[model samples]
Target: MAHEKVNRTKFLFKIIFIIIIIITILSFSTEILFIPTSNNITTPITVLPPSFNSSEEKFLTYLPHSGFHNQHDAFINAIMLSYLTNRTLIMPPILTNYYPPWSTFHSLYNALNKSVIAKKYRKEHCYIKNDGNGENIDNFCDNNKYSKYDNFTMLNWDQLFDLSELKKHVKMVDRGYDFSLDNLISDFNVGENDTYLFIEDKRFEFEFFDNDNSTRQIHEDFEKKFLISDLIKIDKKLLHFASLFHINRIVLENQHNIEFRHLIHNTLIINNSKLLNIANGIIKKLGDKGNYIGLHIRIGDGIYIDEAEDNKILIFNELMNYLLESGLLRNSKKFFKYNLKECVSHNLPIIYLATDANDPRKNLYKFYKNIPCVFTLMDFSKDLENFGNIPSDFDEDTNLKSFYVPIVDLLVTAYGNFFIGTPKSTFSMAAVEINNLYHGKNALVALP
Candidate 1:
């Protein structure tokens, strides 16, 4: 009877153990079971406020040139627009962040935010292979590495939509307008409160401002509006009044032994510190023997590499001769004396920030090492960040996001603030303006 009891007890324990295993499997299955089927999938669309198309709501614009610059601009624009509108701007989940700079700049939806079902269709539809023709080419086309859609990876737009962050409240969208005043009307986020334009073109004229109906009221009745421009000819006085906040400024001052007003022809801002270090180092290396003068070369999109580089070198030589013969550097002798002592140790450096830093013409640097010149490399893979216990995903690019280069930050200063930069980048423009505003008539920061 005791042996029989032992067998029964062991059997009962096995039954319980099996039950527990069954329950654990069911729990995981339930998590995967909730994924919705295609028949029931619905695209997430924002419900706009009644004022969205009304003439009374404002249109805030956040424009960018493209690439990582566009990505950064989108985040910044969303933050500023949210602050202005005082409401959340809803976005559609049909856009991809990855595209050509121009294509991404003008995308109409945020594709990454779509539900898994929508993503299935997008992966099928947004392919160059699926260009609407049913020609399903499934062969292993080994020679097609550089084909239009061969290596295109999707952008992670979903990672950006945290409601807690101010910079992501605004949605990524395309402005439907080029010449039509209606394009301005459609871009307004009526219910959320503000409208923003991240501009790429200078197409709007005073005539483009239309006050038609309730649709036109937003542009007409803005409590605050801003027009941020990197264009060289933007009028500073007009922009300040036009913006709830305008980020550009101008200052007039003279310091050292030179009347800086005479030499203050034009300036651009530089915001990236690594870039600045590269530039500063190159200048120090090249122009260590004399006063250094800097020039930026931007070749046309279609130009040959050989021609552009040759032209740039010739131009540099001519400019140097002019500075000496015209007494430009000599008449303002003390200014250059200060520059020489501060910026170089051996030769006068000539820095070139080419769109394609690899232009074979940059080989000029090899020949002119004694005349030292530098180029800025935007890559920061070598720069390590503080990594204690952060998760791998967050730590992947930590050094880049957390690293602040003061040179880039200073670009937000006022115009003519003394420090200057090249015009090709808005980062530089902002630095110039901020420096001028902060210093407020002081000499440019002199490094030891």
Candidate 2:
């Protein structure tokens, strides 16, 4: 009976073990069927950041037509306007007649450098591309090849800024869109024309007898209007007043002139390495020898005007008298006693003359020939040859070198020990500003 019980217990144990194994297999099979696989898994969807607000509340301004210096003035005013109105400035491409239309910023400056500069400034300001849509536009150098547009060529902004970030805020406009300041301000919908516009608004002509009071009132009025308006287009009038206000504020606050100087320098980039090298060489040569007088003679195109010849002669005489009084030049007697000896020993009596005059031996050139040491752009003929032949008169087909020559001359003039420029000449004005900043003095000025 005991043996029978032991066999029965072993059979019961074996039955229990088999039941456990079956349950384990069922559990494993259930898990294998129910667990998620790669094919069945769901992924979280990603979304891009929202685009800039497409409301009419944003203000836009078009830079007016003019030469490089005037265009630059407009640029500065645009910046001030944008800051005041909290608007995104749509900058016009730098325009020149050399290409019979335009030369883009990229054509004149380092693309990579421009990008870096734009990025640096955009953090504090809203600078957008030509497209109204805030899309990042890169490769400004390649994108703006067809610069010719409506009797004007479009130059790339990369000559001034990287513009990639600014491009993001660009509101693209359709061709031949009405860009009038009144229309832009009054229209409910600007459409693609919102991207960029060029207008010839009249200059704001308001004389302020009391600058402080007038500027304060202007600021107050602008702020009040700007806060309520959905769209504020800066007409020439507003721009002029705003520019005056800001400029006065800067002066009143005793701000460093370097701020303006640096801005101009940073924006007006010279990309041509050969041109830049030549300019640097000239500046260095002048510095190495001794103090030099820099003079800008605006006589080339002036000859065509009625009284321009008389004006030129007057300006020339005034400049000479001023130089003598300022001790930059010695009188005939002083020249023999001091200047002549110094010129012979150290090249102290030298004149670095920059002029639009074509003929080397005629016109204003004759006035400068008597100087002990005189140099003009022609002295750098070998270096300029690298740019190919330059035309005597710029036309639709003028070479890039011809367009760039003035910039090179401007750079050399800016580095002179003392600089004098002609009245109302933007080229001279730019040189004076640059010279003042570089030399830490107010030594640059147009003839009074």
Candidate 3:
């Protein structure tokens, strides 16, 4: 009888364990469970968290396009639109690209670092095959390693942002990846007739001012500014924006709205602790908070690339003038008196260079050679050994550590006491925002 009781207990325990697994699977009806394959590899699946509310409220959404910062801009605009209209927000997966520096950059890097023996010093080129049909093949690197990464990855919203913290100010939700009115309407979120799409010149961007009393003509390029208050009068169930990419897409002129925007920006901090911890470790390696000087230089593409030499000089000089004015240097004449070697000998402030120039040693080294103790993300690879923990967008098989370098640059360089970045580049703009946030300052932090 005693032996039979023990057997029964074991059998019950097994049944309970199986039931718990089933319940857990059912609850995560909207998340991805990584199932490992025979090779100990998992497929790269974009997890779009579903938060379909039963509440009969209107919704607002926009197509997320371009790189991370561009998508970030559109998201901010979408949430503001949702708030102003008092509607729920339907978010699409944030689109990311694995386009590394052009092939020439890699070619130059390999040539420049040929003497360097450390594996950590080597940069990863985009190994994912892409459709470069009918375009200048010279524009991209062809070192395909991961057949799955096609230059783009649809990342979940929470992967880049704290959706819960952001949703506190706005009612945001995601309905898989589709933004089609038909699909959303099918979900019973709204009717076709009840929806309103801001149909404008699809090729050009138009600004939508939030306040009725403000006359802020931000951009004149595709010239069209509409008031957000007018949309509220439509009384529709869903307000769809075809495109909202520009930083000033939704200009907040009202003082109250401006204040609220600041609050929202503060709350919309980078959500990943793993990334922050990695950043903190990098910061510690860089001598910690307020100890170093940060500089972000964007050489840009196309016409900007032609003007790279001139633009980089302008940015570098601006940084110099800034340092001189701030008394960081001994004297205006002695600025850059120490070469990198001498700077290290003298123990001058470390200069962290956050750039998109591909091969900085070849293309940009001459420009900043006079700086004391100049370093890039590659210089601190030992500290960034856990960058693998940094979530990437594409195939899990492909170690797209290169994809997060710019992001890591932003995080690490933001801690510098003196920070300056390229004007008008969204990447630079992000660096400034981050610098300010880390120091408990406003979003538009003062820069040189």
Candidate 4:
């Protein structure tokens, strides 16, 4: 009878334990966040970002804007700030040129290839339109492409970078297109009662300069500096910022803090296996590593086109000076006279040009005139894939190739023995970071 009583007691304890475990899981699942969600997206965005186990832990997120490199800078800042504030970082989706802000990766790529936007991107298929200027452009989708509703996509953080690596430093929640507060509240039971802090900057590009003495440089450049102490002290469940990185927005003062930020920057490597696989293959085929020079010329956008000649001259002068001085060119005077095939016969130094300019050989012949051994991505066109599904009738997808080539260019350039880039170019700066990671002390990426 006593044995029966003991067994009944054990069974009751087991039931109670199971009930407690269920309650614990349910409680942890009710996470909360306050932010802007996508506008009229077709697919339902689920709040799958891991919730904080502890009540004290909050989150830090910001608006991701501009091109990929600029958005990358924002992500770096987001993680650093999240670590500083002892909060989980809610990383925003990577915004590609075709993609709207906060749109996920797959959605962005798929829309670019499958939707009406695909017609616009594959410029060859679209009927060519001429502005008053003689140049024919492929901008038919200029109106509908920007609509967050129509061409909606989001790039999960892990697609570009390794979250496992990021998680090593700070806690992070993968916010894959879950931009809506309504969805967040529904998924995690976020209540209106929850304290929310939103730091929206009225300035065009907000910057947080953290320094004890605001120097003349800061006085002239920044409108005003926000107090770090005030930011840290704010007791809000969700702390958000706006336009954090236009030009290295936050500057860490303390040695520990600065090192931490640097570590995160170093940690932010291009871990996407597909990118590396393509890049590594190129690097191997581009001849043995550290034997060639990588040059990135940006002449397609903004002031770059206007100053293309000057850029060309500066790059030419720098390369000539470097090659002659470094003894890389055995016969400097004769190097230009010989043809590329002949240069190959002589085993001259290889100079790979990564540029936005169309038909670089015809448009910018001067660069090749000086360095006959110059090679562009065109040299390896067959090896590199378009990465988009072109229609059976369409022979070439120039637009899809255009979208992918920049990243490939960046990666390939980063592995070069020497890299020369266009000044004030964020893509160049990003290449420098990757170069530093690979070459470290030997990194010699010069901006002209």
| Whole-model lDDT per candidate | 0.32, 0.47, 0.62, 0.61
lDDT of 2 by residue, 1-448 (tens): 9999999999999999999999999988865552322221121111111113435234444433445565665555454334334444545455544222122222222332233333333322433334422342442222243222212223434543343332232222211223234444444344453433322122332222211332334332222212112223333212212122122122111122233333334444445566667777766666532267777777666423454476557666876786678766643544433332365465455667787778644776545544445677776766667667543221223344645678878888767776778766778877887677666644332211
Q: What is the lDDT of residue 83 in candidate 3?
A: 65
Query: TM-score, each model?
Result: 0.34, 0.52, 0.70, 0.71
Off by over 4 Å in 2: 1-59, 98-152, 160-274, 287-290, 302-304, 322-345, 388-398, 441-448
Q: How many clashing pairs per prediction, in order?
A: 54, 27, 0, 9
- Of the candidates shown, which would achieve the greatest lDDT relative to the real structure? 3
Show the lowest summed lDDT stretch of 10 residues, model 4: 390-399
Compute the lDDT of residue 164 as modeled in candidate 1: 28
Q: Count clashing pairs, candidate 4.
A: 9
lDDT of 4 by residue, 152-225 (tens): 33456776676665575577776555444445434433446554544443433334544555452443345656
**lDDT tens digits, residue span 33-124, model 3:** 32211211121111232344434456777665446776777677777677666567788666554312212322422322221111111124
Q: C-alpha displacement of 220 in model 1, angstroms?
A: 19
Candidate 4, residue 134: Cα displacement in angstroms equals: 33
How displaced is residue 50 in candidate 2, in Å? 8.7
Residue range 382-429, candidate 1, lDDT tens digits: 321212222212123223322223222222112211222433344443
Question: Among these predicted structures, which one has the highest TM-score?
Answer: 4
